[model samples]
Target: MDSSSPASASPPPATAETGRHAYRPKLRWQPDVEEYFAAAYGRDRFALISEALAHPSCYSCIRVNTLKSSTDAVMHKLMDIVSENGLSVGINGLDIGDQNSGSNTHEGNSMVHKCPYTGLENVIFVRGSGPHVLQYDSQPEQSVKEVIVSRKCAESVLRGAQVYVPGVLACSAHVERGDKVAVSVAVEQAVEDGGWAVDAHYEERKGLYIGQGITAMSRAGIFHVPHGIAVEMTERVYQLPSFNGTDILYAESFAS
Candidate 1:
């Protein structure tokens, strides 16, 4: 029953045609925490982490293990490897702006995928694209056959994690393997008193949008199995596009 695997490979390069500004709800920070930070530091410092947490991550940070390999040796090896692999790799110091539009568009869609930035000998930061529109023939808002994952999983998905089997709390009936499905995050109260968890039978109210993914396991396999990825997230509205072929040592670093 362990047929499910994770989402691999960034789609083809993407454009920066982001149209995600409409009715975007802001996730506000708690008042007490904000006040505490403001008192300790200032209003400006208080908002830094809170603001970053609210938005989807636009980059994947990789701090290379300096003990394992020298930074110079790794950087040289990376340059040759990227050129041989047919992806344009630009090494920027702190200049992470105005990336050419052609490089970022993957799967024939649009988002910003910038070149790798190495600000220090051990620190390498690679950028990811989006909050891109999950372009699919969207089903009705009250559509059937939805897969509901817990809040924790939703947070990971916001940060570019695939839908693991253990995170799946419920799924609609007869959901076949490899089906393209809409994913939702269950609200806090979906779990009732006595610590009983929500199941497929519960009349779940509409939940928040994460995005769409391909079903790696059928509905039965998802519930019955204890481990593995339940869905390979394909199109996430809160996109964190992977940087593999172009980013330095990214293949070996992010290899699962």
Candidate 2:
């Protein structure tokens, strides 16, 4: 979808706090499970691992189908895509081979590197930089266009996936196609009824900012469609080079 200024008279921002860091759910484990892990790894180390699980991978790995195309060809194609998108590219961990030479690719802010290990020539890595600062543009008079998504949806979006219609929890009123919108995930809390309830209000404290995108459908269309992309993300707070809307994914069996 194309990107444009958000429509006026949109809903005010949510209760979620504004920041570059992703809003992640706290991990809860059974008493025995926590004890086992804490005993194996120190409590501090175990905590670190748990925290990391809440975030996306720092790098994306793509495995090329050697039967369909060579690694060099895919590398060149990926570099071109990243460069055209105005993201920097760099070659990393390339094994010595005429076809996989670093000089063959252009350089920029983002990085694309070959698998460093042997026997993994078909695999490539695209480095993702993240937690970059984002401005939600929230103000008292001027409202920011927003789309609230499920916790699961936000997790995927942070890891380079697009916002699908089914994952959308709410959309600001008057959000039309091509409008720029801030995306956040609804925080879930357990209720006395034993069911879960999400913080639906678009408050910085209620949800967390994942990134921004251009809507492919209007507020109504998003709910009308059973399944499809609702938002084409332009910026992810945790940046992973995405090949959505491009043939790069189909042409290669990318599994990252």
Tens digit per residue, CA lDDT, model 2, 113-198: 78778998777777666666666664546667888777677766776778888788778888899998888776666679977766
- For model 1 the local lDDT of residue 26 reads 44
Best by lDDT: 2
User: Please, what is the TM-score per model?
Assistant: 0.55, 0.74
lDDT of each: 0.52, 0.67
Candidate 2, poorest ten consecutive residues by summed lDDT: 1-10
Candidate 2 stretches greater than 4 Å from native: 1-25, 89-102, 105-110, 138-140, 191-207, 245-256
TM-score attained by model 2: 0.74
